[model samples]
Target: MPGQLTLQGKVSAGVESGCLVMESGGKQYLLVGGDPAVVKPGAEVEVRGVLKPDLASFCQQGEPLEVSSAKGR
Candidate 1:
Protein backbone atom coordinates (compact mmCIF):
# COMPACT_ATOMS: atom_id res chain seq x y z
CA MET A 1 0.00 0.00 0.00
CA PRO A 2 1.13 3.53 -0.59
CA GLY A 3 2.16 5.36 2.56
CA GLN A 4 1.00 8.79 3.47
CA LEU A 5 3.26 11.80 3.04
CA THR A 6 2.93 15.01 5.01
CA LEU A 7 4.22 18.31 3.71
CA GLN A 8 4.09 21.80 5.18
CA GLY A 9 4.11 24.68 2.76
CA LYS A 10 2.48 27.78 1.38
CA VAL A 11 -0.25 27.83 -1.24
CA SER A 12 1.39 29.09 -4.43
CA ALA A 13 -1.63 29.31 -6.70
CA GLY A 14 -4.83 27.61 -7.88
CA VAL A 15 -8.21 27.86 -6.15
CA GLU A 16 -11.11 26.22 -4.32
CA SER A 17 -13.27 26.08 -7.43
CA GLY A 18 -11.05 23.25 -8.57
CA CYS A 19 -7.28 22.65 -8.38
CA LEU A 20 -4.67 24.44 -6.29
CA VAL A 21 -0.87 24.72 -6.14
CA MET A 22 1.21 24.45 -3.02
CA GLU A 23 4.89 25.16 -2.51
CA SER A 24 7.08 23.42 0.02
CA GLY A 25 10.78 22.93 0.47
CA GLY A 26 11.28 25.11 -2.60
CA LYS A 27 9.21 22.69 -4.68
CA GLN A 28 5.66 23.15 -5.92
CA TYR A 29 2.88 20.57 -6.16
CA LEU A 30 -0.48 20.69 -7.83
CA LEU A 31 -3.33 19.94 -5.46
CA VAL A 32 -6.14 18.87 -7.73
CA GLY A 33 -9.82 19.17 -6.83
CA GLY A 34 -9.12 20.38 -3.31
CA ASP A 35 -11.20 22.27 -0.78
CA PRO A 36 -10.72 26.01 -0.80
CA ALA A 37 -11.68 26.46 2.85
CA VAL A 38 -8.75 24.28 3.84
CA VAL A 39 -6.07 26.40 2.20
CA LYS A 40 -5.14 29.56 0.34
CA PRO A 41 -2.13 31.15 -1.28
CA GLY A 42 0.51 32.37 1.23
CA ALA A 43 -1.20 30.29 3.90
CA GLU A 44 0.91 27.68 5.68
CA VAL A 45 -0.57 24.22 5.55
CA GLU A 46 0.20 20.59 6.22
CA VAL A 47 -0.94 18.32 3.38
CA ARG A 48 -1.21 14.57 3.75
CA GLY A 49 -1.28 12.19 0.80
CA VAL A 50 0.78 9.79 -1.30
CA LEU A 51 3.60 11.38 -3.26
CA LYS A 52 3.63 10.93 -7.02
CA PRO A 53 6.94 10.29 -8.79
CA ASP A 54 6.15 12.57 -11.71
CA LEU A 55 4.57 15.73 -10.43
CA ALA A 56 4.04 17.15 -13.86
CA SER A 57 2.69 13.94 -15.30
CA PHE A 58 -0.12 13.76 -12.79
CA CYS A 59 -2.12 16.57 -14.44
CA GLN A 60 -2.16 14.75 -17.78
CA GLN A 61 -2.42 11.20 -16.56
CA GLY A 62 -4.54 9.88 -13.73
CA GLU A 63 -6.09 12.03 -11.08
CA PRO A 64 -3.66 12.72 -8.28
CA LEU A 65 -4.24 11.18 -4.91
CA GLU A 66 -6.98 12.94 -3.04
CA VAL A 67 -5.76 15.21 -0.32
CA SER A 68 -6.33 13.17 2.82
CA SER A 69 -6.36 16.26 4.95
CA ALA A 70 -4.99 19.74 5.18
CA LYS A 71 -4.25 21.78 8.31
CA GLY A 72 -2.21 24.66 9.49
CA ARG A 73 1.09 23.29 10.66
Candidate 2:
Protein backbone atom coordinates (compact mmCIF):
# COMPACT_ATOMS: atom_id res chain seq x y z
CA MET A 1 0.00 0.00 0.00
CA PRO A 2 2.97 2.29 -0.35
CA GLY A 3 1.69 3.97 -3.46
CA GLN A 4 -1.87 4.01 -2.17
CA LEU A 5 -3.27 7.36 -1.19
CA THR A 6 -5.86 8.08 1.43
CA LEU A 7 -8.00 11.06 0.56
CA GLN A 8 -10.69 12.59 2.72
CA GLY A 9 -13.37 14.70 1.16
CA LYS A 10 -17.03 15.15 0.48
CA VAL A 11 -18.32 13.36 -2.55
CA SER A 12 -19.97 15.50 -5.18
CA ALA A 13 -22.00 14.57 -8.19
CA GLY A 14 -20.07 15.26 -11.34
CA VAL A 15 -21.56 17.45 -14.03
CA GLU A 16 -21.42 14.56 -16.44
CA SER A 17 -23.81 11.67 -16.27
CA GLY A 18 -23.12 9.01 -13.64
CA CYS A 19 -19.93 10.48 -12.31
CA LEU A 20 -18.70 10.89 -8.75
CA VAL A 21 -16.06 13.38 -7.69
CA MET A 22 -14.27 14.69 -4.63
CA GLU A 23 -12.17 17.71 -3.89
CA SER A 24 -8.93 17.50 -2.00
CA GLY A 25 -6.06 19.98 -1.83
CA GLY A 26 -8.00 22.36 -3.98
CA LYS A 27 -8.13 19.85 -6.80
CA GLN A 28 -10.97 17.73 -8.07
CA TYR A 29 -10.48 14.02 -8.61
CA LEU A 30 -12.86 11.68 -10.36
CA LEU A 31 -13.50 8.53 -8.38
CA VAL A 32 -13.99 5.26 -10.19
CA GLY A 33 -13.76 1.46 -10.07
CA GLY A 34 -14.94 1.02 -6.53
CA ASP A 35 -17.95 -0.14 -4.61
CA PRO A 36 -20.97 1.86 -5.68
CA ALA A 37 -22.23 1.77 -2.10
CA VAL A 38 -19.22 3.80 -1.01
CA VAL A 39 -18.71 6.08 -4.00
CA LYS A 40 -21.68 8.32 -3.48
CA PRO A 41 -22.42 12.01 -3.71
CA GLY A 42 -22.72 14.10 -0.52
CA ALA A 43 -21.06 11.41 1.52
CA GLU A 44 -17.96 12.18 3.55
CA VAL A 45 -15.44 9.57 2.58
CA GLU A 46 -11.89 8.48 3.17
CA VAL A 47 -10.89 7.00 -0.16
CA ARG A 48 -7.92 4.82 -0.78
CA GLY A 49 -6.82 4.73 -4.36
CA VAL A 50 -4.16 5.41 -6.93
CA LEU A 51 -4.04 8.12 -9.53
CA LYS A 52 -5.22 6.47 -12.71
CA PRO A 53 -4.85 9.28 -15.13
CA ASP A 54 -5.08 6.91 -18.09
CA LEU A 55 -8.26 5.34 -16.85
CA ALA A 56 -11.04 5.95 -19.33
CA SER A 57 -13.74 8.05 -17.79
CA PHE A 58 -17.14 9.20 -18.85
CA CYS A 59 -17.15 12.22 -16.56
CA GLN A 60 -14.14 13.94 -18.15
CA GLN A 61 -14.13 16.43 -15.35
CA GLY A 62 -11.33 15.63 -12.94
CA GLU A 63 -8.28 13.44 -12.86
CA PRO A 64 -9.34 9.84 -12.68
CA LEU A 65 -8.62 7.88 -9.52
CA GLU A 66 -8.68 4.11 -9.61
CA VAL A 67 -10.28 3.32 -6.30
CA SER A 68 -8.88 0.44 -4.36
CA SER A 69 -11.39 0.86 -1.55
CA ALA A 70 -13.53 3.49 0.08
CA LYS A 71 -15.46 3.98 3.29
CA GLY A 72 -17.61 6.62 4.87
CA ARG A 73 -15.89 9.05 7.17
Candidate 3:
Protein backbone atom coordinates (compact mmCIF):
# COMPACT_ATOMS: atom_id res chain seq x y z
CA MET A 1 0.00 0.00 0.00
CA PRO A 2 2.84 2.33 -0.69
CA GLY A 3 0.86 4.52 -3.03
CA GLN A 4 -2.26 4.50 -0.89
CA LEU A 5 -3.89 7.81 -0.06
CA THR A 6 -6.35 9.24 2.41
CA LEU A 7 -9.39 11.04 1.10
CA GLN A 8 -12.18 12.85 2.88
CA GLY A 9 -15.38 13.94 1.22
CA LYS A 10 -19.11 13.73 1.00
CA VAL A 11 -20.18 10.48 -0.67
CA SER A 12 -22.56 10.48 -3.62
CA ALA A 13 -24.14 7.18 -4.60
CA GLY A 14 -24.85 7.27 -8.29
CA VAL A 15 -28.49 6.38 -8.75
CA GLU A 16 -28.24 5.38 -12.39
CA SER A 17 -24.71 3.95 -12.49
CA GLY A 18 -24.63 2.32 -9.04
CA CYS A 19 -21.25 3.62 -8.07
CA LEU A 20 -20.08 5.31 -4.92
CA VAL A 21 -18.23 8.55 -5.64
CA MET A 22 -16.17 10.89 -3.53
CA GLU A 23 -14.73 14.26 -4.42
CA SER A 24 -11.59 15.48 -2.76
CA GLY A 25 -9.23 18.28 -3.64
CA GLY A 26 -11.32 18.96 -6.72
CA LYS A 27 -10.83 15.41 -7.92
CA GLN A 28 -13.48 12.71 -8.15
CA TYR A 29 -12.91 9.07 -7.28
CA LEU A 30 -15.13 6.07 -7.83
CA LEU A 31 -15.01 4.14 -4.59
CA VAL A 32 -14.99 0.38 -4.15
CA GLY A 33 -14.93 -1.85 -1.06
CA GLY A 34 -14.67 -0.66 2.55
CA ASP A 35 -17.44 -0.66 5.13
CA PRO A 36 -20.42 -0.82 2.79
CA ALA A 37 -22.95 -0.03 5.46
CA VAL A 38 -21.12 3.20 6.21
CA VAL A 39 -20.52 4.51 2.73
CA LYS A 40 -23.74 6.17 1.79
CA PRO A 41 -25.11 9.17 -0.06
CA GLY A 42 -24.52 12.62 1.39
CA ALA A 43 -22.45 11.16 4.20
CA GLU A 44 -19.14 12.62 5.29
CA VAL A 45 -16.47 9.97 4.87
CA GLU A 46 -12.76 9.43 5.28
CA VAL A 47 -11.22 6.73 3.19
CA ARG A 48 -7.80 5.17 2.94
CA GLY A 49 -7.14 3.45 -0.35
CA VAL A 50 -5.15 3.20 -3.55
CA LEU A 51 -6.14 4.07 -7.09
CA LYS A 52 -6.71 1.42 -9.70
CA PRO A 53 -6.83 3.04 -13.11
CA ASP A 54 -7.06 -0.14 -15.16
CA LEU A 55 -10.12 -1.37 -13.33
CA ALA A 56 -13.10 -1.39 -15.67
CA SER A 57 -16.35 -0.07 -14.37
CA PHE A 58 -19.79 0.75 -15.72
CA CYS A 59 -19.67 4.03 -13.88
CA GLN A 60 -16.73 5.65 -15.57
CA GLN A 61 -17.04 9.10 -14.19
CA GLY A 62 -14.13 9.07 -11.73
CA GLU A 63 -10.83 7.40 -10.95
CA PRO A 64 -11.41 4.02 -9.29
CA LEU A 65 -10.22 3.55 -5.72
CA GLU A 66 -9.88 0.16 -4.12
CA VAL A 67 -10.79 1.18 -0.66
CA SER A 68 -8.87 -0.13 2.32
CA SER A 69 -10.99 1.60 4.89
CA ALA A 70 -14.04 3.85 4.96
CA LYS A 71 -15.67 5.45 7.96
CA GLY A 72 -18.09 8.19 8.77
CA ARG A 73 -16.48 11.53 9.40
Top candidate on TM-score is 3
| Residue range 1-73, candidate 1, lDDT tens digits | 3687677877665543345677667666776545667776777888887765555542433325457788876
Please list the residue runs of candidate 3 whose C-alpha ends up more than 4 Å from where it truly belongs after superposition: none
lDDT digits (tens) for residues 1-73 of candidate 3: 6999999999998644668998999999999888878888888999999999999888867899999998898
Which of candidates 1 and 2 reaches a greater lDDT? 2
Clashing pairs in 1: none
Q: Which candidate tops lDDT? A: 3
Least well predicted 10-residue stretch by lDDT in candidate 3: 13-22
Higher-TM-score candidate of 2 and 3: 3
Which sequence of candidate numbers ranks them by lDDT, best first? Answer: 3, 2, 1
In candidate 2, position 2 carries an lDDT of 68
In order, how many clashes per candidate?
0, 0, 0
The parts of candidate 2 lying over 4 Å away from their true place are none
Superposition error at 57 for model 3 (Å): 0.4
lDDT of 3: 0.89
User: Candidate 2 local accuracy as lDDT?
Assistant: 0.88
TM-score of each: 0.61, 0.89, 0.92
Tens-digit lDDT track of model 2 for 1-73: 6678889999999999789999998999999878888889888999999998787877978898889998998
